[model samples]
Target chain A: MLKCNNINVKNILCDVSFEVKRGSFTSIIGKNGSGKTTLANCIASQRKYGGSISLGNTSMLDISPCDRARIMAYLPQSLPSPNISVYDLVTLGRSPHTSLGAKLNKSDIESIDNALAVTGMTMLSNRMVPSLSGGEKQRAFLAMTLAQNTDILLLDEPTAHMDMHVAAEFTELLNRLGKTLIVIMHDLSLAIKYADNVLILDSGKQIFFGSKKDLLVTDTIEKNFNVRKIENDGEIIFTV
Target chain B: MKKLIIIFTPLLCISIILGCAFGSADIMQLIGNDTDTALIIILNLRLPRVIAAVLCGIGLSVSGVLLQCVTGNTLAAPNIIGVNSGAGFCCIVMLTFFPKASVLLQIGAFAGAFITTLVIVGIASHINAFRGTVILAGIAITAVLNACISFLSLLDSDVLTAYNAFSVGGLAGIRMSQLYVPAIIITGCLLCSLILSRRIQLLCLGDAIAASLGVSISKLRIACIILASASAAAVVSFAGLLGFVGLVVPHMARRISGERTSKLLITSSMIGAILVILADLFGRIILAPTEIPVGIIMALIGAPFFFILLFKRRGDNAEM
Candidate 1:
């Protein structure tokens, strides 16, 4: 289990507590500047939190970086310029698994291959990373994260700026993956479609936490998001 | 990758030997007499310069790539942290104050680099922050160091004139002895760099990403800064200030291959060797009777290419 209690975040997430149960798809939906990304960071142990966060049975602070990396993989929302190729970028995800000066072994190569296969990036593997389109770059980063093969994934706005088609498709992809996912997303409709659990955070507090069914209904969004109606269907369409 | 380096190694050796052999004397004359002025000049002047260039090329490019890796900024180079100027200013002081003192000059330059690295690392990056302070200080010092070097160069015209040839960054009179010591220093540092390459790659994605990936960002940054400083010092001790090769060659290497530091380090080193040798060869034949410094030619060619790439990349990376 990944747990946080009475967590306070500055300039982002504040006083939010959530447990990412093992092998469950959890989606965090909130507006811009709602501290969703900050929450992800706190969980990933990228930033310090006020209270306590534990991974499995141990405090996150107690674990080694190598050990923490083995349990969690994070895909940053922003993509840095790739001065090198896609093959190299994906290879970077294997860094946590290796010790200093360790060479890439057959298992490492197999992991990279599996990630590329999963993300459908094998064809563009040899290409330079800077040359890829935005969606393609996202897929490449997804492949890199997948190559880590960690049980927990923390994504900040995984499909925030994407077009409807790609966002819908990627939601399906994340839904099918067998991992503990705590994703920060903006699209309420997409969250309802894919998330097994929904968390609505507004200005850092957890306003609502329950099944995706609660979030898809009109009442929760109206109270937390100041929105009137969302279509009552399997897929929710939030209306202002 | 191992296979690639094996193939590239012998070719580099051939290029280096050819670079070392070219000088005032014909190859035949050097073979004939071991004690002639031609032989002496070749051994003392030309060979020291060539060896210096090789070492500088390797060191500067390594430092440049490592800095870029640590900062996750392509603009990061030894110059960014003022280490180059630190080395240069140290050399200027040693030269102006103690003319004709070679051993002291090397020590002085190395000390300068070491001091600058410490000061920058101390002020800019705490043991916890990755590189906010160092980069800020680097920008500030670049202006200050350039000004100081120019002022000193004017004041110590004699030293300046004597060192002018060194400043142009050629392998003109580099002997095995002159650069061997620095090469050894750089070689040892390179191993440390190899140990940290994977960590540096994680650090390249920015501090948050590095932290999430289970990397100690501050520790890695400090180590990288020191290694980069030492690498810059090693080169500047012998070659003075060879430009563009450090700043540009790593990008070219990255463009060809990928961003793996394990791959980048050797490839960048090889690219540096090729660039220096070709530039030195150009210096040899272009003004054959009177050779120009390879540094001048490198700047002339590399500056334009560097700007173009930078501008183009700004377009490519503007969204970032």
Candidate 2:
């Protein structure tokens, strides 16, 4: 389990506290500039914040970088495609486990292979990253994070640039990963469908944090996202 | 990549042999005659000049690779990005102020290079370190350093000829003793760069990703800049302001070896060494005893190649 106590990130996020249960799919949703990405960065230890974050028994600040990397894997929103093969890119995910010489052992190679298999990128492993399409590139990066074999994954707007079908497929893949995941997402409907719990931020403050069912009944989403819910054909839908 | 290395290693050997043997003296006579003049020319003049050329080539190209990787800009070279000019300008200033102190000249050159790098980095950081912004800041710094160089030349008319020779970039009269410190420094820096190659590859993925992968981006970038500046300063202190080797050699190596930093670093060094030796040989032979400066020859070749690369890449992203 991950716990944040009164986390304040610069001037963007203030007095934010939340708990993310182990093996739960939690989606953080908010408007643009609502500090969702900032909060994600803070949780991943990529950014400095006030207050404390602990992973199980260890404080996040006290964890060594390599140890932190082995525990948590983070994928940024958008990264330019480096001119490297997918195999090499995924192998980079095993960097924390490698020795000073950076040569991969048998276990490292097996992990990379498993990551490639899981992400369905084994066939494209030899292809250069820059040559891959948008969704394929995202999967390649995802494969890299998977190769890291971390217990918790923090993804900042992972599917923002992906097509609807690809996004749905990616969400399904994440749901089946069985790891603790905190995803910052903009698509509310997708969040509603995929997330077990929701954390809503409005102008840097957490207005709501609970089960998705509880979030649906709260006025926080309507007030913060400026969207209204409507009933259509016995199904509930939200529109701005 | 291995094939390129195999092909280029022999070519480099041949170039080194020709560079040392065919310059202003008959190789057979120098070997057979055993006269003091011939011996001195071969041992003291020709050998050191070839060594200097090789070292400068390796140093500049490695510096170029590091700078390009850190900035994520293919156009970021020591020459074009003001590091070379900055060092050269300070060397000239040292000559003007302390004309007799040869040791101080290298120190001045390194100081200038380091300060100029800090300035360029400062400007780049403020502007978010975008490719265009970094290159623009580099160009601006280069212009300013060039102006400073011109001013120094005007201040001390006595230093003009020496400054002109050094600024044109050549291995014409370098002594064997001058190569020792720079050789040690460059070799050390290159080794460090090789060890850091994996981290550099991670850096190419961008800052956030690199950080998430257990790299401290700020520390790595600072180390890269220091290593690059030091290598460039070593070259500029000795070879004057040799341009284009840094700019073109790494790209050529990348095209042949792909983007792996380890392979790229080794190939770039080999290719850079070969290029400088060939350029020096061409400079010595094309005009006979008159001998064009290697820097001029490189610019003559490099300027056109740089323009071609720019034109070919124009349709791509403007960030380059």
Candidate 3:
């Protein structure tokens, strides 16, 4: 389990408290400036925060970065395309587990291969990262995070630049990973459809945190996201 | 790539042999008749110059590779980014103030280059450390340092000839003794660079991804800057602001070796050594008895190549 209590990130997030259960896919939904990304960064320990975040019994702040990386992986929204091959890039995920010279052992190679297979990037593993299209690049990064072999995954706007088909495919992959995942999602319908649980942030404050069904019934989403109405014909839809 | 290395290694060896044999004193003439004069010329004069050029080449190019990786700009080089100028300026100041204290010159040069690098990085860090910002900051620093150098030239006309010689950069009068300290420093730094190659490669992915992969970005950046500046400063202390070997050699290496940092580092050092030796050979032979400075020769070759590269890949600053 990943827990955050009274987490405050200066100027971006404040007084946020939440607990993410193991094997749950939680999507953080909010407006553009609602501090969703900040919350994700704070939890990942990428950004400085006031309160406590713990994985099981250990405090996150107390762990070294390399040791912390072995337990959790965080992928940012966008990255400059590195000139290295996809295989080499994904193998970087093994860095935390490797020694000073970054010599990969047998287990590291197995995990790297597993990550490539899981992401369906085995065919394109030899291609240069800079040559990949947007969706492929995103998948490549996702493979790297998966190769980290961490219990918790924090992804910020993972589907922002991806097309609809690719986004759906990626969401399916995430669902099957079975790790504790905290995703910052911009698309309301996608979040509603894919998330096992939902956390709603409204201008740096945690407005709601509960099961996805409870999130849909509450007025919090409508108020926070400026949704005037939500209806279901064949599927649930929101009109903003 | 392997084929290119195979070809280039032999070419480098030939260049070094030719460079050693055909200086002002003819090695062939003194070889059969008087071995002593031949031995002295070959061992004391030509050999050290050749070795110094090769070492300086390796040092500057490795420094360039590190700077380029950390700054994420192909255009980031020791000469262009104010490292060489800063070192040269500090050496001038030291030489002027403490004329007899030769040890202070090298120390001053390293300190100056390191500090100037810090300033450039500091400015770039505040505003995202983008390519354009780093290049502009470098240009500004270079201009300021050049002005200081000119002022120093006017203040002490007696040191003007020595200053001019150093500034132009040559291997004409170097001895075996002069190369010992720089050779040690360069070798040590090169070893460190090779050890850190994996981490440096991670840096090419940009800050966030590198940090996520357990790299301490700030610490790595500082280490890179220190290593780069120290190497460049050491070279400048002996070679006098040799230009473009750092800028051009890494690019040449990349074309042959791809983007793997370890491979790139090794190949770049080799290519760097070759380029400087060849440049020095041309500098010696072109004017015959009156030698051109290797710095001028490098700029003359490097500037045109740099311009062609810039134009050929106009918009893709990140890749080149």
User: What are the per-model numbers of colliding residue pairs?
Assistant: 16, 0, 0
Across residues B1-320, which tens digit of lDDT does each residue of candidate 1 receive?
78758867887788777766775457666566754866666566666666666677789889988888877666777777887778777888878888878678767777887788788788775444545567777877777877887888898678788667656665654557667778888897788988888788777666666776778777788888888888888877777667777789888777655777878888888778777876876778676778878889889888988877777767454321
Per-residue accuracy of model 3 over A121-217 as CA lDDT, tens digit each: 9999999988998889988999999999999888999999988888878888888898988999887877878888988888898888889888777
Q: Provide the clash count, candidate 3.
A: 0
What tier of docking accuracy does candidate 1 attain? medium
Predicted model with the maximum TM-score: 3
Q: Candidate 1: where are CA atoms >4 Å away? A: A81-85, A214-218, A226-235, B2-14, B28-48, B96-102, B127-132, B146-173, B308-315, B318-320
Query: lDDT by residue for model 2 over B46-158, one digit each (tens)?
Result: 78988998998899999999989988888789877778778878888888888999777767877888788888878877776544565788899899889988888898787
Candidate 2, A122-224: lDDT as tens digits: 9999998888988899899999999999999999988999988999899888898899999999888778778889998888988888998898777777777
Each candidate's lDDT (Cα)? Answer: 0.78, 0.85, 0.84
RMSD of each: 3.3, 3.2, 3.0
Task: After the best TM-score superposition of candidate 3, give how far the Cα of residue A129 lies from its true spot, in angstroms.
Answer: 0.9
DockQ of each: 0.60, 0.57, 0.55
How would the candidate models be sorted by TM-score, starting from the highest? 3, 2, 1
TM-score of chain A of each: 0.93, 0.95, 0.94
iRMSD, all candidates: 1.7, 1.2, 1.4
Fnat scores for every prediction: 0.70, 0.49, 0.49
The full ranking of all candidates by DockQ, starting with the best, is 1, 2, 3
